[model samples]
Target: MRSKPFLTVAHRLAILAYIVVALFPLFWLLKVSVTPNDLLYSEGVRMWPSRATFEHYTFVIAHSAFPTFFKNSLIVAGSTAVAVTILASLAGYALSRFRFRAKYWIVALMLVTQMFPLVMLVAPIFKMLSPLGLTNSLTGLVIVYTAFNVPFATFLMQSFFDGIPRDLEEAAMIDGATQFVAFRQIILPLTLPGIAATLGFVFTAAWSELLFALMLISGNDAATFPVGLLTFVSKFSVDFGQMMAAGILALIPACLFFLLIQRYLVQGLTAGAVKG
Candidate 1:
């Protein structure tokens, strides 16, 4: 009985340790971004520099093509998230609530798509997109991101649907609501947490995607944030300070995006806690 408190204390300590470990990189990134170029190498090992300046941030914002990169990434990631969520919601509802022929095969096929290496697909995808005048375009990126994200997203939404009671939808239908009407009004509201989860997942995936962006977009005009970060690198040296500053800046939109959906995210975390 006395061991219970000890175990609880140990568990809390472990979680605290994990949080510190997980956040250490972000802390370091913030630390280094504000560290002046001179002090960066001179006092790189310090947890916080002796002196810090926002020169790196100023340079990244004022002099670089980061704004364009930021805009491109926002458009691609946002579009992909919305598109994936809408399609996944419909497909998931179908998979969860309805049984049809080839259902098993369809699920298996989606699983198979996830099995292959993304690296292997890069060359084929590039070749396919190149001739369509999409190699250096934002639309191309959105289409690609949506395709890659949909299968897993469908599975995610389907799980949420499965958690819902079919009786609710049936009752709605019995009250003269059509299946589509029941789904739109009665079911979708209850699945807000799942939709939030899917949006966050897909948005982050598209926002941080580098390999596809790097391969598909060669011009700076269409380049995403990840590709834009590479501009801070050159043959002679890497601009660590500016790069870190840009990285810190890049995190803002994603953080804000999550903040916007934080209520649903909290609900997602606490879902299924109590039974009525």
Candidate 2:
């Protein structure tokens, strides 16, 4: 009943509204980060402050322990992403292509693992890591993240592999290429979108994770960004400006990481849409 132009305009408006709603918190964070300390309490909720300053940003970067926290988060997230992707790719391929005994049981066990709350597992994980000198360490964090992320990542990659025809790999094997060689040289290239998605998901999960980082890492030197954010909260007050500034700074790597993979991310996310 509606005109095409009217429907088109409605669609666009809906998308614009969604974008604004999604980004409003980030806009508020930036506004608070740049607002001067004096005007924050004096003036309640202005779209833009009368004046803004970089003093919070300066203090967070130069005077605080944020850089160390940033570095630790980067290391843990990067390592976990790479490790989980590699392991998941191999495991997912096997699950998609091979028929073996106890496969269903194995998958069931993995599903069971995901069912338990992470909080329930944390104490035992810490106990297991402490004896091995892995607690309070980045390597420990990477291992923990990889373990937690692997099941879902493997399932994600398995779905991607399922979407592809198996004949391509068969053709490669027929040409005298071993299965592993064909996988590494041929199929892996086609799976880039899935790899990007898995890397992005795992990286983001590890990046913003607060519980494990807070529980495992006691020393400030080993703390990740999520844990470091707590430093802004003291006995009586929270430093909203510096904390917001740190939050903004913390958003950079994640943004850049996704930007780097967004091409593949788009493909990965949309690949399933055409199936219907």
Candidate 3:
């Protein structure tokens, strides 16, 4: 009994430590954002600032192009996440339910695509998109992001589909429902966790993507938040406060996205446990 209590305490402490370690950077970013510029360096590693202000945030919102960047990022990431999830759901369902001669080769080809460094393909992708007038366009970024994310998202959804029992869909079909109806009304509801996970994964990827955005987008109007953040850097100095403020603001959509999906994620996990 004593040993069990000690183990429980140890587990709690370990989790607490991990949480602190993981969140310290974000905490620091928030800390710095609120800290006054004069006291930033002078504070010398204090956990909180003696004086805090919202001036940085105010400046970013009122005087900067951050709002535009935020809008562009929301549009790109939201569209890409929705597109990938839809495609991934269909592809994942097909892969999970069907046995075809080409399935192995198809999976292998996707795995091969992941094996190559993205940098190697950037030039070729650019060359291809340039001819189609997709360069520097949000549509181009969405296309690129969707293509890159769909394969992994498909695999994610497939694993979820595999976890569901075939008998569930079989029973639904026996009631005169079509396969598509069975999938839509029965199988999909059960795979909510997988769908939520895929959406969050793709959204986070599209939200933080920088390299492709930088390489393909040339002007400020089309810039996503990650690329927009670069505007804070100059040869002589960096705007640490404004940058941190923007970072915090950028975190809002992602935080809200996860919050919205978290309930479904939990329900999915619980359902899986019960099924198991």
Clashing pairs in 1: none
Q: Kindly report which residue stretches of model 2 are placed more than 4 angstroms away from their true locations once superposed.
A: 268-276
Give a tens-digit lDDT track for model 3, residues 87-128: 999999999999999999999988887887899989999999
TM-scores of all candidate predictions against the true structure: 0.95, 0.94, 0.94
Per-residue lDDT of candidate 2, residues 95-163 (tens digit)? 999999989998998888899889999899999999999999999999999999999999999998887
lDDT against the true structure, each candidate: 0.94, 0.93, 0.94
Task: Give candidate 3's error at residue 250 in angstroms.
Answer: 0.6
**Which of candidates 1 and 2 reaches a greater lDDT?**
1
The per-prediction CA RMSD against the true structure, in angstroms, equals 2.2, 2.8, 2.0
> Native-vs-model 2 lDDT?
0.93
Query: How much is 122 displaced in model 2, in angstroms?
Result: 1.6
